[model samples]
Target chain A: MTDRTPGTRSSSGYSAWRLIAEELRAEIGDGRLRAGDRLPTEAALAERFSVNRHTARQATATLAEDGLVESRRGSGTYVTGEAMRLHRIGVRTRLTKSLGEKASASGNLRVLNSAVEDAPTDIARRLALDGGKAVRIETTRSAGGQQISMSTHWFDVSRLPDIATVLRRTGSVTSALRESGVDDYVRTSTVVGARHATASEVAVLDLGQGAIVLVTEGLDSLTDGTPLQHVVTRFAAQRVRLDIEHPRAD
Target chain B: MTDRTPGTRSSSGYSAWRLIAEELRAEIGDGRLRAGDRLPTEAALAERFSVNRHTARQATATLAEDGLVESRRGSGTYVTGEAMRLHRIGVRTRLTKSLGEKASASGNLRVLNSAVEDAPTDIARRLALDGGKAVRIETTRSAGGQQISMSTHWFDVSRLPDIATVLRRTGSVTSALRESGVDDYVRTSTVVGARHATASEVAVLDLGQGAIVLVTEGLDSLTDGTPLQHVVTRFAAQRVRLDIEHPRAD
Candidate 1:
């Protein structure tokens, strides 16, 4: 740790617990505090921040509520955010491959649903469709029996007519496309963000009531640059980190 | 519209309301349902899902609670997610530059806190520091008078002893570093992810009680790869999306 004063008395209007919690959160986020590390006792925290014990308790309580820390009944409070596993994205960026061995159930991908649908305007544009319907595939991927991500992929039906069935059989989008005679597709673009897990996401991903999901929208194309698939994938934020790789700069 | 059934009968053990909510969430996520769009009435939703009105009502209520949809008295339920704006990251992903003009309050950057601290191991390695203290600068970024991100940037004190004071004075990291005798830098690595907003984040970012922050850990180095700064930035997920550009595939 810094050994310097908190120096994080950054917000004037925020509550005392808030500033303390933010400081602790930053330490945890940056690895100065790791999982299983015991936090200072309430009295210690109180003296350190020049606040009352109750205020210190409130700060720890806030971290506990967010699953960032856990308060043992007798033992001291401890950090709980287990150094998030990294998910790397690059020129090829395949979910199953990028997730590596970490995303597991023994690591399996399953098709939850599939059907043909009139392309939504946005999906159609991304797939470069010309008045044709698209095959939609919904899937869930798990690691250690916990759902890691839910992906919905859309493909131009005229080009990959049996993509839905093939995906179900192959249990892999990359393989499904290859079976449909389109081998060696490349990721064209990726847009990332985050959002609160919805009610459905909570139940399906088995997340806590107010958890968050890291969302990635991607497109893959033929070597010739023809758009082949559009996918929206949401990963359990608590479990995944994204590593973006770039070529050396000038 | 799909012209087909919702096709989201994806979950087996989940309740009827959860299935309906999940299907609706996917539509909203993919832009089939956009901001300010009126959702089908409860009666319509029940008929479409083969469920009862109460089940349908529960679904809409959940969306309302998450701020994804809202009930407008007798008018009807409608989608409320505002089509997230994009934040692009590249070799030189300057927050002020990447955010363009969308991040507001006249788009000014200000120091929240600055100090000299013993460098944490992870940050020490990132900045290539050698047992020396580091200059830490904490900042919050805002747009439209709303906080967008909170960042903590660390620089090796031995190499840039005047960074903290310089950053506070210039109010711009790029300009501050230039004045510190480092005229050129390149972003060599970036790791992105998301997490639920901590108590402090909710207060400073002016987010809903249960919100998420899109996080990016970045490392910038001088032209010859001598580490310059290590920053951890957390953005309000509701307001910003990250656009990651890559070199076209082979």
Candidate 2:
């Protein structure tokens, strides 16, 4: 039993199952156990660790509960790894382009509110507009039929006079911009931050209060460097990971 | 007085102070009120908003508690604007190079533990080590006299023997690598994620139990593209924003 046992325990005591789970978790983290790999049977794990069947079952259960594994009714448990989709943000990030096939196929946008409002002073500066007011569009974006982000966009109203109407028809800012005669845009800057979701975010994104929201404040401009849009997007942190690329540095 | 009031109150009904705070928060978020901008005086804000001084004070107090503003002795309140430092991660992210002058001058690393241990399977693969064992170093880093991050690093011992000794003398992994005859390396990939601080992270980083930690799991390779290191660093999400740049994308 001693020879078969793996992992060293420190003097500070942990439960038998917990130690087993930690060792396995490290294996998963390190890459010994990969996604879709079947875990050993309870009896085999018990025998290898010199623990009882109950402990082995508990260890696998812990891993499953943590979303590291899945147990089918007939088939044995298998590693799931992260299981979350990777969203890449590059110099030219398009929501449709960055998302995976399933997300891209099912991605939908709902305009919660759209109006020509007094542009916040900063938004005015970013959009390079003279007036205090600009067009504001609040939207909830869903992917794979689940709400993923709440985005508030500010645009210079005079430049895109019928943006709200165009956005309503297109259900996409990029498409609306294209209709407005702006063919292409690139991300100029992005400030990435995180904060607890506000009550409205909790409701809009269907997340718990205090859930982490990955906040991206970004500016996008025309290919000619004419600023076009300033957007603030709050993403459900658990559901998405923002991959930001800094192209100029390389 | 009520005629001067701004912002539409939701059905849930917020206090005058909260409405004021929200508007100010939006302004700050949009970049109207930038860092070091002195806020309007309490009397001025109360007059402009048609609210009492107490309400204005409450708004500023709320912002202060949220780390958006700071009150100095005899000096007016100013927008601190997030207060947290931005730590940029890129193809060649060096802690000293990424941090600002204050952080760079004061930043320190404390070795929590160093040992030759079974590399987590994923880390083993990242380092291209055939053997299961690797050198592990756990550390806590601080700047401006506050704990900032807890990092766990794995290195293939065969490639860089006595790394711990070199790290101890240099207090920097990059320097230790240089000492080991590896002149330079670059980040290959980074996985950015966030989760509630673990117990050990909370204790080591001096954070509340449920505080968020921004995690980056990454691998570094030599200029010639030989994998050299796998590191997992967790930053106090409230205190630092990881600015990732995709150098190759540009």
Candidate 3:
């Protein structure tokens, strides 16, 4: 073990603890320390870094404050798993996934089922579609060979002249609707809920029984109050966590 | 087959759809339907409720809007599961049982470990304690027969006189701290992260290997800038979903 003596202040006059924290952070960034990996105890860490126990503890505390590690009772501090990127739900500009990047991530789409069906009565009213004129697009998406999410989107057929042809070729309802000359749409509202997965959902998402699924239904409307899309998406509960950050109005 | 006759209402009215939605909502509240139970399809439900396919669809949509059920495309609608109650991270509300019955839902504290060792260099500075004058209380808590979480709370030994006697009798760090004449404390900051469960955490919380754990560290300070308590809590990820709501100030 190295001597447990506080290091001399460097040329920059930085404290021993700050320097140690910076080194450990660099190691984590370089993929040396990974999620669930435990660092040495205070004594061992002090010896390893050639610092007193107090200085070593200070470095670790700094890491904890920055959300890099978690210290449990009786359990040594371990690296955090995945960090979630939080975004405000209502902001539209931040929603884009960079079309080029998203295309490269996964270009394959599974057309689960589609039909020229009448809008469900409630959807008809919400979309203001004629009594029996709506087209539905149901699709499932996968990423990295794992099922990511499933969505069913509804659009008024009257609004799209060639809805079927567009859906068949593009495989994206958003793109299909946009191609149909509809623009300037706003997501009016979204309702969220959680539920146990059905047998088919479990099979499609490869989830175990009793695993919860979060569902979000979003309604988009044109500038003239014409409903453009009523889309519902179901996400695998275990693999994803939804964060809705509301913007603060100053 | 249910008739496809279009209802004569051009605008809004107490449509047949609203009546059916009320019945389904009542069934859920009365426990006839439960989380994870599947509902019959539009065809079957229309036949049973004596309504058109459109009306049946409308009823289901209303439930979906209310966050009561989730409808997966090509599959079916199922009851939404109830997850954990959302709590703002820095909000200092007294933790209480779900049922509102304190005695039955109260948590039991198990003092896993305790020590009066020298403060780790970092902790000493944070707590403003001398190297040899800090006490750490490591505790695990169980609620409703389940190990809900574990916490490590540190205190300055000088401020807390006869800590062992108070801890042994009160069985609560918050209560003991209050009894020792400390007041006007506020949570200064909190750090949160997620990770896979450790072997001991899995055993204690009865969690699976892949289950996620949500860890939060909270620091509290008195009005005079004296550190009051430092607590770290780990919550079972599957059983709880963290919800944080902040008012948007535009």
Candidate 4:
């Protein structure tokens, strides 16, 4: 009554279920499991692997833990990566447009605070400014009514004295910068990471306990690589999938 | 002695701590507070924000929860994002190099199993195979002697019967593909997300409870976007940072 896949060791190294997870993970990696594609039913996997359905569920659960797949309520497990609303990271990516259907518009952005503050050493360095005070703006953003991101921005007050007023009115950082005689800027670099939501973040983002948020600290620069802005953002990991694209090397 | 930051709301909307977090987060965003940089001491921030040390600690803790800042043992809080160890995402990125010190060579790879398996419909489609059998390979990888990633790979048996042997011998997937007549390939796109670690993953990754991992499901192509490989990789988010870069427009 001991059913197992033929021609594989069962008791030596990894268990039967882990072996299955390995294969499934490979499939996901190799593009067999595209984002948003539903995995086989537990029964189907169990029968195929000659194991019980419980073992099959274990395999999918591991994928869920890694954010590779997710189990929807009453539905089956779906490949999670790249399936959620896509947030494109690129030179000219617009904040709202990149979120696609998940985000409403810049109009929905909330300007929570604006003040003049000491430009910390690093901040002053990136902005090409000397040690001085700068304009700081704090904002929270949402997607489809769910709070998704929170950000803080700093600008050299002497360069953009009206930046706070423009940011409050437009709710768009790009527009605000443009009005200050900076015609255009592009994202120069982005470093991405993830961590658990803070207690305060949970209250704002409405996350369940142990929820993770994707953090990005990025720099924007003018065409010739003059740094203009440095921003850090926390995105609710469940609502967004980040697509990091690299251009062809000529 | 109710000292507060002058000209800001206190008893109206958010509490003082939340507003402090908001301000600090903005600093992080705008490059005032940079990744890897130590924040002001609790006493210093308390004086700066005009709040008590308890309130200041609460603000920093919120940043920590969001993975923006981290408190080290006796080392104070440091920004957690961009500084954790940069994992550069680019067309020519090498796995070991991208990880910096976090990964060793492909020599650390261990092949767990190899067998022939039916190509699931989706897997078949991405691999450009019909409904037929394919070779499956499973492997677990480590960094600095710590288990970091596990992967499964599939190849059309007819196209490369010796793939498993080649991968095992060279310990490099690119070399294996190279031996099979694929001269070169590039990462076409990548989808990045994060989630909690599973029980099995926790044991393998040696992570504390509620730890998060960065999952990337990416596609590699033969310079023409002709899909060559699809892979999902899980990285301990604490050990690595991913830099998603955008190339300049000529």
Candidate 5:
């Protein structure tokens, strides 16, 4: 039943399944397993690991749980293209990376609108600012010259000392934040939902009447847990997909 | 320090933190705590639960881990809308419900393309069919009036009798399979990925050039583990967010 030669194992007392999963995970991480590659069957895997069918199945399930493999009912299991790509660090990172990857692949981002305004009540509360003290940055992002999303990110002016100067000079909020010395931060929370696009969103995104919108609001904080930013992004439903990678607990 | 009346429990059996979390969870499940509703400060929760500040924070952390609440650095935790609305289930249930929900959300199916062509080598192997014998159905779906997603589902004609008649009459593939007397079935496996949309997918989805596509491919099987179907769905990136809720084994 062995379809591939069993690799030499290290001295540690790891289970056959763990060893096999590590091998496959290494391959995926190292870029050897491309998106469309087909993996060996369970029987073959069992033989290679010198284990029973149950152990082989468990190993395969581990990979599947990690979003690494796809199995068809009558068809065999195969590697998915999505599993080959590296996910961004946090929710916002995921969003920005997804957009950047797609945009870089076939298009470019265009700044449709850029403005500074008073933070909305929700944003104000999220940023922990007095009602009128929070500053909001609004930008409409486009790909291939077509608008895809509108983002409004709020920052507490008390924390961000020179917002207007940074906005006028750099244009990228992330870059500005980093330049301002708050480089180490993690996404504290993300809330996502879907609804019909508003008239302005429809006009800007060029969406049809029936098109929906996916909304994501997130908060980011420093390591010591100081809330740094709050951002809300709305995407034209027809144009994008949001993927979240969930690692299984051991 | 009590901000509001304590819940049914005034127990010292469980830790005060545990009691507080249970109360909040019950509130969320019962819809008393709606999405976007902010919780009271740590001091307030501490007073209500008769717990120390650290214990109250720990309770909030538990809620955050379950994706039931969002905690900003300085701002208090708030209920997440999606967390309240969507139930994260296993991969099998996700695939089944996704199709059902998509169809329900999008009122009609528009046959973007269909053919009785030879399956690609990868697809043929996936369906366990001779390369040329697999029948493919390609459909684009729309909600209200605008396009939302595209799907390509395949079946081996040799295994599925009267495929054309079933497709023509039932409209729903799951229903078609049910009518064919294939009552006992389960999703054997699923693969998921995110990527830049292809030119064809972009056109079919009406997505902007930079929009990401979330793709899910799976196999459904009979109780005896006989493969029944292979299906692939491409969702417009901005329209949907994939959530996988894994149970912790602690």
Candidate 6:
């Protein structure tokens, strides 16, 4: 709040309201303002910025347009939860770890369906099965009662026949793999892309059809170099930001 | 192609048209069909898939809907250049390497604008230069005459006073940094997100307003751990996919 008065459009020449909005955005970005915290009243903001109430309202309006804040009819404007959740992706990236160990109790995996089917060409090629059959699992993962991602995972049924059963019991892919005697696996490659959510994705993720979905296609291989699984995950972009940690080349 | 006859709905129970589209999509995905390659005519596809012309037409329609192919009317449809350019994100990832050395002559960075201004709060904080002035460079990178990304970069002006001059001479950030006598740098962090393109982005990227843009915010630091710059790049979703290579923990 260091004199964010936007004095006469210093160097950047940004309008006063725009500067105010930017300051608020920075506050949220840097954690000075947390998600869902109600902003000060317009009068307070105006007095602080040495501006009129109308100017303060304009700033809030700008924030709303950026999906950073929400205004209530009777209450003050509050920051939206759009600061975004950072999902770190690494060689050993684990969804469970990213979601947090404490979240496990409150989170659950809903297996929409499971079936044995001829692997799609892309999945088949990635898994090196070449037209072989695989177990396809459609699942939605939720954390703290909020939907996080919808994923379709394909695994060669020949290698792990009891995955669905184990998954159902454990609600954990790692646990299921361990039960199936996989021991361990590591992600070999990940292809990240983005697209507008489809109709089904919109309904499944409870997001707008036009919303963006961060698509990740990953291939995991066992320590012995045997391909184990190929998965496609669609993450709600508004809620998740992918943090890629590149290892140092020593 | 692998008897993609669709056989009046294979074991998966997908419709003949859907199976046909899947087969074609696979061909494109697997590099069998290249961008700009003309797809088989409806009659040819009908004969090949053992379906009627109507079914083949429906398949092409589905591909068109998915943005995998475009109908050219009178002429056969062509595979859209959406097979995706994989941009690897790693500690030592280089844009030149991702775009390929062969593309260097064809790919060029077009400087849209540059200005010296008080650093925006978010950029300032990321560069650890709050309230400091920086040089902002706006650039659009093109490879083989097609726009790939639009990036805005901020660097401490005090450290690199002649960045704009060097950038203009070399048309590369790395080259400019080298010219400014800053030898080595490494990416410390990268945050990847996505959102619908804005009007200006839609125009610049030649995409629809609702088209997705892959946003990456990255920080680079000197080898000695001093922060050097912050950059925000928006990539056209349809044109690029980020390949994240996680180092093997041997």
All DockQ scores: 0.29, 0.16, 0.03, 0.25, 0.03, 0.25
Q: In model 1, state the lDDT of residue A139.
A: 89
> What lDDT would candidate 3 get against the real structure?
0.59
The TM-scores, one per candidate, come to 0.75, 0.71, 0.41, 0.69, 0.38, 0.75
Alpha carbon RMSD to native, model 1? 7.4
For candidate 1, list the clashing residue pairs, or say none: A104-A107, A104-A143, A104-A144, B103-B143, B104-B143, B104-B144
Cα lDDT of candidate 1 equals: 0.75
Q: Across residues B1-250, which tens digit of lDDT does each residue of candidate 5 receive?
A: 2323333332211234544664575456434677899987888887776667787787687677556689877777898764422323232443335544534632365544556767767778867786558778787765534455678878887777565567556555656777887765665555454444543565577753223455656676666766677877666644454444322212
* lDDT tens digits, residue span A40-83, model 2: 99999898887889989987987775566899889999998454
Expressed as tens digits, the lDDT of each residue in B137-198 for candidate 6 is 99888775567789888999888988987887788888889889987798878888887564
- Top candidate on DockQ is 1
- Share of native C-alpha contacts between chains A and B (below 8 angstroms) recovered by candidate 2: 0.21
* lDDT of each residue in B1-250, candidate 3, tens digit only: 1122223231212245654554565456323587888988989878776667887898798677555689987879998864233333323424443312322423476777788767656667778786547778877766544555677777888887566567656776656667788644656555444444444565677653223456655677775566777676666644443333332222
Docking class of 6: acceptable
Better of 2 and 4 by TM-score: 2
What lDDT tens digits, residue by residue, belong to model 5 across residues A96-165? 4566555453233333444456766656777777755766666666654446677776777778867646
Worst 10 residues of 2 chain B by lDDT: B6-15
Candidate 5 stretches greater than 4 Å from native: A1-97, A100-121, A130-132, A164-168, B1-84, B88-250
DockQ of predicted model 4: 0.25
lDDT of 4 by residue, B1-250 (tens): 2123622333222356655665676556545667789989889988987778898887787667656788889989898764345667878667766655656666767777899888667667887767767888877676665566666676778777888899889888878889988888888878888765544555566654345678887767787656666566777776666887678754
Stretches of model 1 off by over 4 angstroms after superposition: A1-32, A39-83, A102-107, B1-32, B38-83, B102-107
Instruction: Please state the error at residue B5 of candidate 4 in Å.
Output: 21
Candidate 1 structure quality by residue, lDDT tens digits, A4-53: 23333332223566557656765776567899999989999888877789
